[model samples]
Target chain A: MFQSTGEIIDGVAKITLKGELDAAASGQFKDTIEKMAEQNPKKVVMFMEELDFMASSGLRVLIFAKQKMGAGVDIHLIGCQEPVLNSLEMSGFHHSVYLQETYSEV
Target chain B: MEALQLPATLDALGPIRDYVSEASKKAGLERKAAYNLKLAIDEIATNVILHGYEEAGLSGEIKISFEMNDEKIVLVLEDRGKPYDSRRHEDPSEADLELPLEERAIGGLGIFLALKGVDGFDYQSENGNNRNVFSMNRPN
Candidate 1:
């Protein structure tokens, strides 16, 4: 399952993901991003503290998100677990997105 | 694991992964190499459990073996599911992702990732048997 809870705090569109991101979850993920893409947020902050795992399909979805949203939308991955981080790094996604230790309320 | 008739499906994949991870570590393989082994094993196992049986009642044999030499890890994965090479399919193109969500493929990405992640991946179908050889080398 993939979910994105967005709430703008301090002008950043903070999206929190809480679920296993796998092949089964890609559809929901893509739809979530498509909805958010219309908002035209300057920065997209992802809270992954609760995200337990990530698969290649999930990573691909994020790659799609980046491409769909364009360069104006800054994407920040906050509090990513090791498995999620490892997958992104192995897939060369780390270079395409931003990763941070925490959100600090946006 | 042998009694399950096919590649047994477990609630969790930690042990199968741990077993392979430990073996690769003992051989002085890199961490990335170990992880790739685990991923490849999972892809094969998932395919077996999801498609191996005949009408969900019958079962078959799925054999797996491993070896490492000179900074490379080798794995032999075999499943008696309907004779089909899991590696024969092409990965979905970037264009495919542009289509409607409902038309998207499922489970194809894992097989695609496994093929691309491993260093020396090869396959050959023989006499009702499907086999895959996956290998990875230590990172620089």
Candidate 2:
């Protein structure tokens, strides 16, 4: 199961993603992105501490989020597990998104 | 051989990943090796379901089999959708990797990752089915 909760803190749109992020769960992530995009926040930080798995479909949504949020808005991925991070790095997506060890660290 | 058949859909990928993960662990694969096995299979499986079926307006099933040899675990994914050979496809280039986010094309990234994450990747067509065989050797 994938769950996402959104909140605005210090003018940043923060989304906490828990559970696995596979093809079936990407739709919900995209929907949350759309909602956050509507708020037009300057930054969007995804908290992925509990996201244990991520498929290519989930990666595509992150790509989509970058496009939807536009060039001006920054997207940060925090606390992604090694496997999930490997997918990003292998596909050259790690360069596109900001990756931090922790949300507070970024 | 342990075989399982699943409908060719995006939703099937999650369970497929789980199945492969457990099977790899049982086969005595290390944590990273098992993780790579799941990633490689998920990438190929996603392509089989999306491009082979969803984009092509076709429906079929993906049959997966897990077999263990003395040195390696072999995973075979077979699908009846349109033929696509991963061997013939061009992997993402190093120059492409250096390209900025906006300029880089995301196309073929999945296959690139799949091929890189596995020990070996082979593709062949047999009896009107696209067969992708991926293997990972046990970590020494």
Candidate 3:
């Protein structure tokens, strides 16, 4: 099962992701991204420490977020597990977003 | 050797991944190899469900089996959905991987990662069934 929660605080969108992000979960992830995009946050921070697995479909949603949020908004992925990191690196998506072990305001 | 059969649907992906994880453990694969195997199987299984079954307007079961030996562990997935040759698709070039977000396309990344994540990958079609074989060598 996949669960996600998001809230915008001080122009930063904080989202926490848990469980497997497979094809079925990508739609929900996209919905969360869409909602965050509507708020026009200057930065988007995703907490993925609890996220166990991610498939290609999940990567697509990350791509969607980058395009929807535009170049000015920085997306930060925090505490991603090794497997998840591997997925991002293999797809060359690591370069598109900021990966952090902990979230800190820039 | 062990096997499992599940309906070709998105909901089954979690269980399918669990099965691969268990098989990886049984084969005594290291962390990196185990994760790679899991990702490889997940990608092909997703394709079988989404493209081969859902897109083709067909419903079927995907049969997954694995065999372990001294040299390697081999996982095979068989589906009766649309026949597809994953090898037909090309891996993204270095330039493609380096493309900026605006220029990037999501298409074919799954298959590319699937093929690249494993030590060996093979695809075959026989009697209307598409078989995907993924293997990882055992550490000496």
For each candidate in the order shown, give its overall lDDT on alpha carbons. Answer: 0.64, 0.83, 0.89
lDDT of 2 by residue, A41-104 (tens): 8898999989987777777787778888787788899999988888888777777888998767
Q: Which stretches in model 1 have alpha-carbon errors above 4 Å?
A: A1-53, A56-77, A81-83, A86-100, B1-7, B10-12, B54-57, B96-107, B138-140
Per-residue lDDT of candidate 1, residues B1-140 (tens digit): 22112334432233445456666776676765666666766665556545654435546666666776777767776766665566677766766644433334433566765676678888777876777777778544
Off by over 4 Å in 2: none
- Candidate 1 CAPRI-style tier: incorrect
What's the TM for model 2?
Answer: 0.92
lDDT of candidate 2 over B1-140, digit per residue (tens): 46889899987888788789878987899888888789889888888898888899999899888888788888889999988988788877788876656665546677777788889889998788899999999765
Q: Pick the candidate with the highest TM-score.
A: 3
Give the Cα error of residue A67 in candidate 2, in Å: 1.9
Residue A35, candidate 2: alpha-carbon lDDT? 91
**Top lDDT model:** 3
Residues B1-140 of candidate 3: C-alpha lDDT, one tens digit per residue: 45889889987888888888998898889998998898888888999999999999999899889998999999899999998889998898988887866578867699887888899999999999889999999887
**Best candidate according to DockQ:** 3
Q: Give per-residue lDDT, candidate 2, residue B81.
A: 92
Native A-B interface contacts kept, per candidate = 0.08, 0.37, 0.58
| Candidate 3 ranges beyond 4 A from true positions | none
RMSD of each: 6.3, 1.9, 1.2
